[model samples]
Target: MPNATATPPAFRYQGWSLFSLLAALVLLMTVMILIINPDLTEGVRSAIRATARSSFVLFLLAFTASAFAVLVPSPLSKSLVRERRFIGLAFAFSHLIHAVLIYWYGQLNTEFWPGRTALGNVPGTVGYVFVLLLALTSFKSTTRLIGATAWKRLHTTGMWVLAAIFAYSNFKRIPMSDWYVLPFGLICAATAIRLMGKLAQANKRQSLQRVA
Candidate 1:
């Protein structure tokens, strides 16, 4: 018989299974949004918005996973850290859908691309560039090719850049609608959590070194 004091193993969703599940959910949600809205252009726009929101959520999870694990030290937080890679990939997948819908929307609406200034597109374009680079380097083979140090630098930079982009994207929209404040506040809070986690880890390391 098992010892009564033994702890149960933490449940986790990992590998391709987690990615597939997340991707399927994003796809299903996008399809449902499109189907529910009868207008083709409006439906596509709504789908784009839906995918963007999904991408933001996945990005936050991946971005904060390590921090949460360090700060909270819970089974769920540990699972998130383990599953961070797949969750990041799912974010990439959702953003890819967002890109595709944007392109489709542009094709359907003649003024869509022309109406936007170059400056207005800069943030999103840079964000997508980082997303593509980060997604490409996510695999073992690619990470190995890049060297561990380089991979770490790239991912760290990419995540921060993406976070800033998200914050800016939402902040700029606040003028359009007050609802934008909620996401902006969320990003700010996530940033604070990550920063606190890093400080805690650094302090812990220093303490261990001093004791040793």
Candidate 2:
């Protein structure tokens, strides 16, 4: 018989299943946005925007999962920590769609690429490089191949780079639309939460050492 005092298994979404669901929703949303807009070029642009927003949300979740799990210690936060890998994968997938749409837009609208300066492109190019690296190294086989220390460094650096890119992207757009402030504010808050969580973890370790 099951022991009465035994705790039930905590509810958590399966990793790949969660990734698949999130990815499908992103695709569905993109398709709906495209269909709703009559102009093909405009539709593609809108889809690009939509995917960017979705990717940002997913990235934030993965970025702060551990922090939330540590600071809040709720089932939901713990579940996020458990499923961070897949959530990050879903973010990469969303960005892949966003990239494809951007490319398609450039092809359809010849002026699209020419309008942006080389310097303006550097941050996005670097961000994609980090995204690709992070996604590739996320697999167990690849993580093992790289060694745990290297993997941790790479992930840590990549996340910070991506966070900076997101913040910069939104901050630069505020002049065009006040709405950009919302995402910029969110990234700032997430950054603070992550930092606090790290500090809390360090303090906990120090306390344990003192007790010892």
Task: Provide the overall lDDT of each model, using Cα atoms, as 2-decimal numbers.
Answer: 0.93, 0.93
Off by over 4 Å in 1: 1-12
TM-score of 1: 0.95
Residue 197 Cα positional deviation in candidate 1, in Å, after optimal superposition: 0.7
lDDT of 1 at 105: 98
Poorest lDDT segment (10 consecutive residues) of candidate 2: 5-14
> For model 1, what is the C-alpha lDDT against the true structure?
0.93
lDDT at 139, model 1: 97
Candidate 2 lDDT at 136 equals 99
Off by over 4 Å in 2: 1-12
